[model samples]
Target: MLNLVLFGPPGAGKGTQSEKLINKYNLVHLSTGDLLRSQIAAGTELGLQAKSLMDKGILVPDEVVIGMIDTKLNENPSAAGFIFDGFPRTVRQAEALDTLLGQHNTGITVMVALVVDQEELTKRLLLRGQTSGRADDQNEELIRRRVQEYNEKTTPVASYYEQQGKYVAIDGIGEIDQIFGLICQKVEAAQSLES
Candidate 1:
């Protein structure tokens, strides 16, 4: 399996690129944010709890996110691969994911991080807020908090993958196609190495 971890802060174009990657690679999209939003939309107890934390720009507890991911992995036993977005936000979560994937006889192929400046992320998110109707994107303070949280808690995930020689960083400030092409090059290279 060609499992990939699409890493970035909010508004880093992971969603857009993930769609392209999924189409090209035939990978299952395991987006935790979407999963949580679905739960929230259904008004489940977990959704209510996640909504409360998400509104405050706080990450939902690791176990909740991990459980959701475990369920998805079980649901797709014969997937070509999976593109993981908005997940493994902390090193502990990364470790948990490694263990989870190991139990299934597969692991992350690579982690492609979209490197964008904080100022740009804020601008993109604010503009997205105008159309996305997502409350989290509408407030500047909340957006900053979310990015800061990612920096503090999630940046180390790069090191975790880097240690495994499976981390690649691409500039996220160019045309969408250009950035995606760069990602494809890196992904193809990783696939070759795996083969």
Candidate 2:
């Protein structure tokens, strides 16, 4: 299976690229943010829990998020593979993911980190906020906090994958297709190495 993780700061176009990759490669795109939103919209137990934490500008506990992912994986056991987006945001979650996948005899094949400048990210996010009506994106303070949280808590996960020789960094600037092409090249190379 070609299990992969798409890593990037918010507004780095990870969602856009993940959707395209899923369509082209038949990979299941599992976005933690989307999953949480779905649960919230559905008024599920997990959703209620996460909603409260998110409203407070605090991260949902790792255990809650991991449980949600576990459910998704169980429900998609026959899927070809998965593209994890906006997940493993903490080293604890990354470690938990390793254990969860290990139980299924599967491991992450590669982790692709989309590199973008902070200024560019901020501009993209503000634009997205205006278009998407997402409250988090609309506030510069919140956006900055999100980026800071990503840098402090989530960026280490990339190094974790790097230590395992499964990390690939790609430029996240330019046209969407151009960035995606760079991602595909790295993914293909990783597949080749695995084979």
Candidate 3:
């Protein structure tokens, strides 16, 4: 299976590119944000818990996120692959993910990180906030906190994948199609190795 982790901070275009990659690779999209949103919309207890932390621009607890991912993995037993978007935010989460995939006889093929500067990310997120109506996105202070959180908490996960020689970085400041094309090249290269 061509499992992949789409790595990036908020407003790095992971959602936009995930759609394209899913269509091209026939990979199931396992987006933690979408998963949490569904739970929140349903008013589930888990949703309420996630909402409290999310409202403060904080990450939902790892166990909660992992449990959700486990459910998704079980729901799709014969998936061609999966594109994990906005997940494995911590090295511990990455290790847990590796264990989960191992139980299924597969592993992350690559981690493609969209490299965008903090200032640019802040600008992109503010523009996105205007339309997204997501409270977390609308506030400048929250957006900066989100970016800083990613830098402090999530960037280390890159080194985890890098140690496995499965990390790829692509410039995220460009035409959408152009950036995606770069990602596709890296993904295809990894897929070839898998075969």
Candidate 4:
């Protein structure tokens, strides 16, 4: 399996890159944000519980997210692998994910983070807010908070993978194709090491 964690702060082009990576890798794209949104739109119990928290830019409880992930994993028994986006926001979540994957005898292949400065992220997100229809994206304060939250709460997940020698950082300030190519190179290199 070629499981990957496409890591990046908000507006770092993770959704865009994940789309391209999934196209090439035939990987199951499991974006927790998308999943939560779908559930919210469907009015599922978890979604109902998460909507208020999300609107406030707070992460949902780990157990709720983990339950959703378990369901997704079970749903894709024959997947080539998965591209995990918007997940493992805390080191604890990363550890939980490790345990979950270990239960299935699989593990993360790599966590390839897109490193972009905060200014670029703010610009990209404000631009995105215009068309994204995402309430959280429209507020500059919220975007800053989200980025701050990621830095404080989520960056450690990279270190978690780094300790395992599976973290790669790619420059995200460039043409989309160039960034994609760089990511592909990193993924290929990681997979080779895994093999």
Candidate 5:
């Protein structure tokens, strides 16, 4: 399995790059945000609980997020691999994910961290807001908060993976395809070593 964790701040183009990588490599794109949105739209019980917290601008409980991920993994047992985006936002979650995957005799093969300047991230997010109509992206304060949260919470998860020799940082300031090229190169290198 070629499981990967695509890590980056909001507007760092992690989502865009993950899409391209998935298309080119035949990896399942498992975006936590998209999954949560689906759950919310479906009005599942987990969605209802998460919705209340999200509506108030609070983080969803880790357990709730993990439960959703567990469900998805169970449903996609036959998938070749997965590109996990917007997940394992903390070291605790990272450890939990390791345990979950280990139970299946699989583990994360690589962690790709997309590095972009804060200014560029803000600019991209503002433009994305115009097209995406996402309230969080449209509001500058919220976007800043989200970026700060990612730094405080998610960055350490990258370091954790780095200690395990599974982290690869990619420059995220360029055309979409350019950024993806860097990522693909790193992924191919990592997979070759494993093979």
Candidate 6:
């Protein structure tokens, strides 16, 4: 198993890279955002709760999100591995994730963080907004807020993985393929070490 956490600020290209990684590695993609959307679509209690928070531009509670992850994990008993995106935003959530994986006798293999500057992220997100038509992306205020939120709440999670010798930072500039190649190298290196 080669469980991975794709870590980065908003517009850092986690989605794009995760798509390629999953295709190449046969890993299940567990994106918390997609999970929340599905729950809301199904009108589950947790989804309703998450919707209320998300509507206010706030994050859903960790336990609610974690429970969703639990469900996903249980649903895929035979997955080669999983690529986790946008779930563990704080140290507490990171701890919870480790415990959850521990219950399954596996743990995060690596946390591949895509490093991008604030200005570049803002530019990229706004450009994406033109095509994405996501209301949050259209507002520069919201974009900056999202980045700041990640800086304050999420960056420490990288350090948590770093302490465990499972953190790798990749520059998030230049061509998409180039960046993804770097990510692939990091993941393969980690896999080799584990083997």
Highest lDDT scorer: 1
> Which pairs in model 5 have colliding backbones?
none
What is the Cα-based lDDT of residue 57 in candidate 4? 84
lDDT of 3 at 177: 98
List model 1 lDDT by residue over 100-165, tens digit each.
999989999999999999999999999999998999999999999999999999888999999999
Return the clash pairs for model 3, or none: none
- Report the C-alpha lDDT of model 6 over 10-128, residue by residue, as the tens digit: 89998999999999999999999889988888998888988887766688889988888998899999999999998789999999999999998899999999999999999999999
Give the RMSD in angstroms, all C-alphas superposed, for model 4: 0.8
Candidate with the greatest TM-score versus the true structure: 1
- Per-residue accuracy of model 2 over 73-118 as CA lDDT, tens digit each: 8999988889999888887888999998998778788999998888
Score candidate 3 by lDDT. 0.93
Q: Write the per-residue lDDT of candidate 5 for residues 170-192, one digit (tens) a residue.
A: 88887888788888888988899
lDDT of 3 by residue, 29-135 (tens): 99999999999999999999999999988899888888888899999999999999998999999999999899989999999999999889989999988998888
Clashes of each: 0, 0, 0, 0, 0, 0
Candidate 5 global lDDT = 0.86
| Angstrom error at residue 34, model 4 | 0.2
Model 1, position 44, has a per-residue lDDT of 100
Lowest lDDT sum, 10 consecutive residues, model 5, at 50-59
As a whole number from 0 to 100, the lDDT of residue 33 in candidate 3 is 96
Instruction: Tell me how far the alpha carbon of residue 14 in candidate 5 is from the true structure, in angstroms, after superposition.
Output: 1.4
Query: Against the true structure, what is each candidate's TM-score?
Result: 0.99, 0.96, 0.98, 0.98, 0.94, 0.95
Candidate 4, position 105, lDDT:
88
lDDT of 4 by residue, 2-99 (tens): 99999899999999999999999999999999999999999988888899898888899998888889999999999999999988889999999999
